[model samples]
Target: MSGGLIGLSGLIILFVLLIIRIPVAFAMFAVGFAGIWVLRDLNSAMSLLASESFTIASSAELVVVPLFILMGNVASVTGMSARLYDAAYAIVGQIRGGLALATVLGCAGFAALSGSSVASALTMGKVSMDQMNRFDYDNRLSTGVVAAGGTLGILIPPSTGFVIYAILTQQSIGRLFLAGILPGLLLLSMFMLTVVLLCWLMPGFGPRGPKSTMREKGRKMAGALPVLLVVILTIGGIYGGLFSPVEASAVGAGLVILIGVLEGRLGFARFWEAAKSSIVTSATVMLILISAHLINPFLALTHIPTLIGEYLSALDVAPMVVLGLILLTYLVLGCFLEGFAMLVLTMPIFFPVITQLGMDPIWFGVLVVLTLEMGLISPPVGVNVFVVKSVATDVPLGRIFAGVMPFWIAMLVTLAILVAFPQIALILPNTMIE
Candidate 1:
């Protein structure tokens, strides 16, 4: 069979495997290795697979993955997430829908520590759900906010999404991390606005909590200061040229461990559990990266990206129009696929077209990450929604999905603003030290 035909068939089989509950890494691996073997030879396939796995695993830059994951997990065990939530709640929890807003802020804070959306959602959900429940807040709004806010984990600085994108596109990881800051804060503000607007339209949905004393507020804020300091030092270190992204991850992880020990909240058992969890998450990411490397070569052998690029470039529409269509494809795909899966599956086809059109890669990275954030809260397979459901078992899945609708629209607005002013995503990266 022709290489194009084989590539097409391989892609179909890969998706079929995914739909049948196969892990994405294994599916990509099986299809990729097989495709390369057919197009080239068995020896070439085995050689590429072995080399790619080692190269990805041994790469010094990827140390950020487990380190940052460990930092977040340790923070969670040490009760830093709860302190952050309490601090946000103290600041905003008294207003209508304030608890929800606090939830978004808490998620943003947790996102800074943990780059994984699932971890952010699960951690913040456990921290904030009971408080929202305590105030007789609508379950839909409560669960929805946690699910939606959790997605910020991947758009914020130190995000795994940006790290993966940087590696795939060969862009600077530091610049990508910087590029995410403005867009991340923009989404956070928009999410808060959605909560406010929803409460205005129906105050009963999110009733206000009793105001805290100024002393109480100060205490909670003080309680959260340590983690806040870690966030600032790590991200600020990158922005100030004091640390590379990998270096920043190491420092952040180290500080979190130290704080846990000093506070006596992270026991040997807890620390070991955090390390084990980070290992599992990191291993999964590494396998996916290796599989992606194999698939990239197979796709090149088939000339699939070149074909798609030529076809896209030949269209009569403006480049921005083509970009819009590509994003729309992402929107449609988001409903079914997880964010990382979508990135690896589509970037090989789309990233080339993006560069061919002369768009900035960093801006495109932010845009794509935003779309991935949307997917996390989207229907049919909204991973964050399911995660929220897992934590708030009393709330039905449908309610959680319904609650996230407003925040989803808020994300759409944020995306439009970023597209209209690409500077929003590019400003920090453009000015960063080379």
Candidate 2:
């Protein structure tokens, strides 16, 4: 039997394991180990495992992942989300569906610090939903905006997804990060625009309140200035080459702690909690990554990625058609899998095909991140949706899902734009690095 077919059988076993509710990391690892043993020998497989683990563990770039995650955990536990939301509300709260708009904006701002979508959604929903409900905003609209907006966590800088993609594809983490900035802001704009449009069309969807005086607006802006500065200093330093991503994360974490202490918001208890959470989260990510390395070499031995790339390249297909299909597949797979697991599993198979077809890796990363956003809000296992439901249990899951539909449409529209004009995701990275 051919090596590829032997590898193909491993894939089948992996899927069966997944369907039986095996953890994704261990399932992939087991299948990969078995595949290597079958194709070569147990000794070679054991050597590969030993060597790959050391290499992945020793990489300098990998430090950025845990550091950034630690920064996020610190910012989250220090009550940064509430402060950002208050600042957002002060700016937009008086407008039609203002609180909803604020929720989206707040999520985007919070996302700058927190790289996890589930964390962002959970934090923002807990802090923002009651205010939205108080404003008499539609349940679906409020829930939808927050859930969709939480996805920006990865779309913006310091994302675990971007780090993983860079590592997997051997791309520069800094460039991958720069590539996402404009697209992230662009999506943020589109999200805000969608809220406005919805309010304009269906006035009852979001009710307008008394406009704030200039003085009040100024105070709100000032209240949020510290966070804005943190974002600018950390993200700005990384993009501007003043600090490496890892150093930038350290700076960010320090700044968050400083701000929290100055404001008397981050006591020892909160700091300890954040530290413990960061350690646990970092351990989990490292485990998944180790598992990915195991599966990756096995998949490479199959040369299936090459075969898939050749098949895709040979097809009489428009790149956009293929792009759409890939996205639709993500949308479907999203219903069952969380974003991180899905990316780790599929990128090995799909990214090569897309890259060989002359697609930009940076653009593809944004597209993948955007597509993963849907998975966060999609039914069954939508991480963000489940988060919102957990916080607002009185609200039905159906209503939260229903509310998120418009935002989902907004996300789809943004995806179409990125696909149509690859420049949207590429221009910043290209020029910035030059």
Best by lDDT: 1
Candidate 1 — worst ten consecutive residues by lDDT sum?
425-434
Give the Å shift of residue 132 in candidate 2. 1.5
* CA lDDT, candidate 2, residue 431: 90
lDDT of 2 at 146: 79
Give one digit per residue, the lDDT tens place, for model 2 in 325-366.
Answer: 788889999888767778887887788778777888888988
Which candidate number has the best TM-score?
A: 1
Q: What is the Cα-based TM-score of model 2?
A: 0.94
lDDT of 2: 0.84
> Clashing pairs in model 2?
140-403
Give the per-residue lDDT digits (tens) of candidate 1, residues 69-117: 9999999989999999999999998899999999999999999999989
